[model samples]
Target: MSSISLPLGGDVRKTRQNSLTLLINRFGVFFMILVLSGVGLIVSPGFFSSTNLLNILNAVSYLGIVAAGIAFVIFCGQYGDMSAPMTMAISGVISVEFMRYGLVPAFLAAMATGLVIGAVNGYIVGKFRANAIIWTLAMNFILEGLVRWSYKGTQIYPDMATEKTYQTGFFLPLLAKLDRHIMDIDLVSRAQAFNGLATTYPLGVPLVLYVMFAVMIIGYIVMSKTTFGNQLRVVGSSYEVGRMSGINATGTVMKAFMMSSLFASIAGIFMTSLNRVGAFYIGQGYDFQAVTAIILGGMSLSGGRGSMIGVFGGVFTLGLISNILTLVGIGTFTQKMITGFLFIVVVAVNARSLRKLGRDYA
Candidate 1:
C-alpha cells in the first residue's frame, strides 16, 4: 500500500483541535449553570436579586466546603469517606463543648480530633488495604452511636462561657481582625471591624461564604498546581502503576484522607457558628450531598480526572437548583426526587465521557 502524505499544517491543526476539546471538557459545567440560571431568572423574577443570590451562597457555603474535601478523596482515587457527616457532627459538638476553654483551644482540639479520625481511616484503608466503603460506613455508624450516647440527644451551645469570652473584648477583636483580613477591609475602627466579622458583609455576602471561597481556592491550588497534586493524579489513575513507578501511593492516600478530614472539621466549625448550636444531627445528610456535588462537578468516581473549579460549579449549581425549587413552591420530597434524577444523569454522562477518554473502571 502506498503511504499518503499528510498536509503541511496537520500537526498545528491537531494541536489546536485538542486544545479546544480540553477547554470544553474542563468548563462543561458552565453550560449547565447558564441553562439552570436562565431558567431560574425566567421563572422567578427574584432569582437574580442581590439578596436572593447571597442567600444561595450562604446556604451552600458549608456544603461547598465539604465538597472540596470530598473532591480531595476522589482525586486520591478512593471511593469516599462515609464518616464525613458524623465527623462534622462530632467535631461541631466537640468544638462547642471546648469553647469553654477558648476559641483557639477549641479550634485546635476539634481539628486534632478530626486528624485522629483521619489517621485511623488512612491507616485502615491506605496501609492495611481495607475496603474504603465498608470501613468508612462502619466508622460512620460508630461515630453516630457515640455521639448520641455521649450527648444523650442534648444539643450543645455557646452558652454563658462563650458570652464571657466575647465580652472580654479579646476574642471578638481578634475575630474582627480575621474578618478584615478575609474581606480585605481598610477601616481599622474596632466597631466597624466587629460589625464586619459578626454579620453579613458588603452587599449581603455572609462571612461563611468567604470561608467557602478561601477553602475552594486553596483546594484548587493544592490539587492542580502542586507536586503533590501530580503524584495524586498518578496514584489515582493507577495504583499498581504508581507503585511500580516509585510513587508512595499509600502515603498520598493517607494525606488525602487527612486533608479531607481537616477541611470537614473546618466546615463543622462554620456550621456550628451559623446554627449557634451543635447536635448529633447537625450534619446528618451532608456526606451524601458532598458526594453528589463531587460527582456532579464532573470528577470521575474512578478518580484522577477532575478540576476543583468544576466541583465549585457543581456546588453552586446544586444550591441554585435548591433555591429555585424553594422559590417555586416545590416540596422538599419532590426536590429530592429531582436532585436524585439529576445525579444519576450526571454520573452516567461522566462515566460515558471517561470511557471515551480511554479510562477503564472495573
Candidate 2:
C-alpha cells in the first residue's frame, strides 16, 4: 500500500512564508539599529569612539532592565505598568532610608516594599480584572503623594548622611548611624558594576552590564522555554480559549504583573544606588520609556508576540539616538520633541502593520 502525501505547493508556500516572517522579525529592528549606527558614525564626530560607544551601552543597561520587566507583563497580554515609576521611587527611598540601619535590613526593606506593591498590583489588575493602566496610574499618584508627604519632598543622600554636619530629617533617626556603601555611587562607578565603564577591555566589563544581560537571558528563557511562558502565550493569544484549555489565566496574569513590578523595584534599587540619592522622583518617566522601548522592539501592545533580543536592540537604538542628539548639540527640549516625534512615527507604523495583518487574516 502506498502512503498518501499532501500537496507540495501549500507546504512550500507555507515554508516560504514562515521563512520570510522569521527573517523580518529577526532583522527588522537590527536593520534599523545598523542604519542608525551608520548615521551616527557619519554625522557625529565621536560616534564610533570607544568612549561614546560605552556610554551608549551603559545608558542602555538602565532602560534595558525596566523594559525587561515591562516585557513580562506584555507577554501575558496585560497593559503596561503605569505604577512602575512610583514603585521605583518608593523602593529606592525605602532602601536609602533604611541603609542607615544596616545593609541587610535596608535591602530587605526595599525588596519587601517592591514585592508587596507587586502583589497589590497583581491582585487588583489580574484577579479582580481591574483596568491595568488606570488602576496602576492611580496607584502611582497615591504612592507619589505618600512619598512626598513622608519625605517632605526631600532626598536621601548616603554620602551626605555620613558626615556629622550634614544631618537631615529621617523617618527613623534612631537607626541612622550605620555606614554602608550601598548607595556609594563613587565606589560603584569606579568598580563599574552597574554603570558602563569609560575604559574599554573586551573582558573588563561592568557588573551591571552583566546583570542586564542576565535579566535578558532569564527573560528569554522564561518566555520561550518554561511552562509558565507557554501558558502566558496561550492566555495572551486568547483568554477564552486558554480558559477552555484549563490554563489558569488569572493566576498567570497576576504572576506576570507581580514579576513586572518586581523588576521595576530592582530598577529602582539600581537607580537609587547609582544616583547616591533617593528622591520621590527617582524613576520618573521610566514607565513610558519602557513602553516605547517595547514598541520599538516590535512587540504588540495587544501582547502574545515578541522576543528579548529585539527588546535589547530597541533599547540600544534609543540610547544611540539620545547619545547622538547630545553629541550634535541638541538642547533638552529639542531632544524631547525629537524623541516624541520618533515615538509617534514608530507607533503609527506598528499600528498600520498590525491592521494590515488583521485584514489579511480576515
Give each model a TM-score.
Answer: 0.82, 0.82
**How far off is residue 157 in model 1, in Å?**
2.7
- The Cα local distance difference test for each model comes to 0.76, 0.74
What TM-score does prediction 2 earn?
0.82
- The lowest-lDDT stretch of 10 consecutive residues in candidate 2 is 190-199
Q: What value does the lDDT take at residue 25 in candidate 1?
A: 65
- lDDT (Cα, tens digit) per residue for candidate 1, span 113-173: 7888888887788878788778988998988888766656556555433323322222333
What are the per-residue Cα lDDT tens digits for candidate 2 across 94-201? 776665445566667887887788778877877777878899899999999888876677776654544442244434443434534434434333323322221234
Model 2: lDDT equals: 0.74
- Model 2, residue 316: displacement in angstroms? 0.6
